[model samples]
Target: MTPFRLGVLVNPLAGLGGSVALKGSDDVAEQALALGAEPKAQQRMLQALSLCRPHFNNIEFKTASGSMGADLLEQLGVTAQVLHQLEPEAVTTADDTTAAAAALLDSGVDLLLFAGGDGTARDICSLLEARGRSDRQVVLGVPAGVKIHSGVYGITPKASGEVVALMAQGELVSSMMAEVRDIDEVAFRQGQVRAKHYGEMRIPEALKFVQAVKMGGQEIKELVLDDICAEFIERMDSDCQYIMGSGSTVAAVMAELGFDNTLLGVDLIDCDGVIASDLTASQLLEQIDHRPTKLVVTLIGGQGHLFGRGNQQLSPQLLRHLGADNIIILATKSKLEALEGRPMISDTGDPELDVALAGWYPIITGYHDEVLYPLQ
Candidate 1:
């Protein structure tokens, strides 16, 4: 059997601005780092590739040199052909991403699995478009960036790996063209959103795993949100620490409580008020350790992802510590209906934890209204 050639690329600075409230990591990678932002793209890439380990023999890996790709593969004990090399001491830039993409595409890999956010997608998309190979080449993204408006990414890192593993095992996986969209970090930080379409790229059509382009704007049903917030506020336990997950739905809960919210980052709050704002994975773990904690999360509008989308701060360890029973999912009935019967996904990176989280749970949709929903 001809081994499936998989090209891997990692934008090391991706998602560094997220937890620190920088909105996006584009030009301020250094500022984000100075504010204590840790590089997460590599770790996220690890999560996806770890799942591909069992199918290693069936796959041929090719990647860029150093932190861009080879480092993680080396950590996994997988030897990959290095098609592009980078200066080990220099910071990675968009040019490096494009160069790596060009090399990988030229190598005739079956699939290009890159890790980064929307900007990274644009880099790869531009390269493919320049060569007029956008339709012929198949690529997939592991969501590691702060702004992920692109449809080329999997809903989670593990989801990306799952798609690759299926292909490695000789399963038939369809391909489709997905749009690439990105927002202006300048406007984004100023509390204004300016999303623009960049281009589209071909990707595997794993609908269950690949996310749709993020649904922009706020929820139109204001009253539905009011009722959901009412129900959540009414049920708050004074002794319990609430780990507020990101999303407009969850933000409404914080608003109703008269507390400021991190719309795209995790927050730790209690009945009194905000305990901590914009916490990273380690900070979150430190604060919630051994406490009676509950996670208030909502699904990504069009993606139907309950975890591993924007809120990577809720690490697998944290989710396991909180236990499945401690989670409170909030969503509007209309949002649930948008899925058209697909189960909400729990791509928390840990496949075992994701499976353990699968089951029917009551989703609070309004004041005194709870609907039973399945989370897979």
Candidate 2:
């Protein structure tokens, strides 16, 4: 078997800003730093390179000039020849990214490993299509973005590392369809949520996540999650007050329990989905005069995130009470591969809180059957 000739490209500007802070990344640079999105692209890029180093000892590592991909590799001790870069300390733009990717293809690399989110994916896709070399080039993603809606990325850094190692081994892997999705930052800043699909690529599924399929049937879609949740609610078995996180799935349980639940808001429920307090985090703790409450949640379709992104009320205190074991994840087969391997992401306003829920956890996508999905 031929050991792979891999091309490494790092977008040092990626995830430079995000919604981790009280405020998300601003359209301008001044706004990015205010929200704690410093120029950590270099840091994240180095991390990905550090992970790549162990696999190839004498491989040719091609990168653009500057922090785009060159400096990051240099810092990680990758003594490969530089590509078409002019500076090592500067940052690379999307223009530089596409050009360098095309250069790497002409030089004959086995796979092109890129570090960034969906935006970076779009650039790579453009280059591949321009060169008519999409099929010849293999790609992988290192997750370091705010909204990465691509199946080319692994669920987490660790999972991504694992996928790359397997690829280096020359195993029979399949190229998953990596789609291009970008949120309209301008509109989003103006409180309008707009996401557009740019394109698709077939990368190795062993690396990234698939979007969950959307459940159907007004009757059945409404019934499965609700019925399952209702049975679990009835079995709460203790006065351990409950917190009802919002969603139509959770609403099903409330429907069975004869309680009117807010479909989009977090609700505090009894062990039986009875809304005791549809309050905020502070209000939730106030209403719970008991111990050991459980948090019921379901995976999001197309993203697979359970807590951090949608429900903001499952705070650290709430998780401590619900416990990891008590955190229930529900999804249907239809929505399991929405983005392929990208685990459901949670952006619950805290980066530390978000990473705390990292690692793989058991998800009940069906009755009595569970799949271990990454939650980082």
Candidate 3:
């Protein structure tokens, strides 16, 4: 039997700004480094590959040289054929990514698995689209970027591996065309997000494993928020700390209460008013320590992700502390219908927690309207 041909690529600088609150890691790699931002793409890619190790004997891995691809696989005891070589002491760039993707395209690989964010997705998709081969190849992404607005990536690294394993086993892994979205990083860092579709690529259809393209939060109806805010305000506890997640829907709740809110950052609120603005994971933990806390979050429009998209401040540990009962989900009826019956999802980066959050939950859609939706 012929081994499954898989191409691996990694953007080593991806996700360098996530923990440091840079919003994105596009051109500010230096600043992120100055702020002690470390490499995350490699570690995340390793997690995906480690999960795929069970099928190592049945797959042939092809990748770029050194840190871009081959080194990490080698570290995992999996040999990968190197197709492109980087100059000594040279930093990899978009050029390197396209060159490697082109080589893999010609190598007749079954799938192209990349580790990076939306920019990396655009690179590969642009290269393939230029060659008119974008529709012919199957691609999957390991989420390792600060901004992952693209639909090509899996919800998490381990989920990416699950898709690979299914494909390798000759199982029924369907394929579909998904958008490769990108955002203006400059505007993003400045607390503005401008997401646009670069192009579409062939992605494996594993709804549970692959994430949908991020929907703009501004699409929600303002009137619906009024209702949600009323309901939320009525239930507010004077002593409980409210960790509000990022999104316009949640922002409405803040505005309704006359509290200033960061449109794209996590905030903390209490009965008094805004406690802290645009907080980090550490800051949130510090404020919520030994106190009753409720996480108020709104889902991304079309993606249906409850966590692990842009709101990394609500880390796995934070969600675990808040628990399921204390989570308040707010969304418009349009947003829920946009999913077309798909379940709400959370890739908190903790598989166990993800499972715990996979059951059904009631979503606050309006003032007196609540609907139970499956969260997977």
lDDT of each structure? 0.85, 0.62, 0.81
lDDT of 1 by residue, 1-376 (tens): 4467789999999999999999989999889999999999999999999998889997789999999999999999998999999996888899999999889877767789999999999999999888777865778999999989999999999999998887676443455678999998898889999999999997875433221222444544777788889989898988899999999999988998999999999999999999999999999889877578999999987788999999999999999888766899998766776876667888989999987776545578777656555677
Clashes of 2: 30
Angstrom error of the Cα, residue 116, model 2: value is: 1.6
Residue lDDT tens for model 3, 156-253: 99999888887665443456678999999888878888999899987776533221222335433566678888888887998798999999889989
TM, every model: 0.55, 0.50, 0.55
- Pitting candidate 2 against candidate 3, the one with the higher lDDT is 3
After the best TM-score superposition of candidate 2, give how far the Cα of residue 8 lies from its true spot, in angstroms.
Answer: 1.0
Model 2 misplaced regions, further than 4 Å: 19-36, 88-91, 207-376
Cα shift from native, residue 126, model 1 (Å): 0.6
Please report the candidate that would top lDDT against the real structure: 1
Error of 3 at 229 (Å): 50
Ranking by lDDT: 1, 3, 2
Off by over 4 Å in 1: 207-376
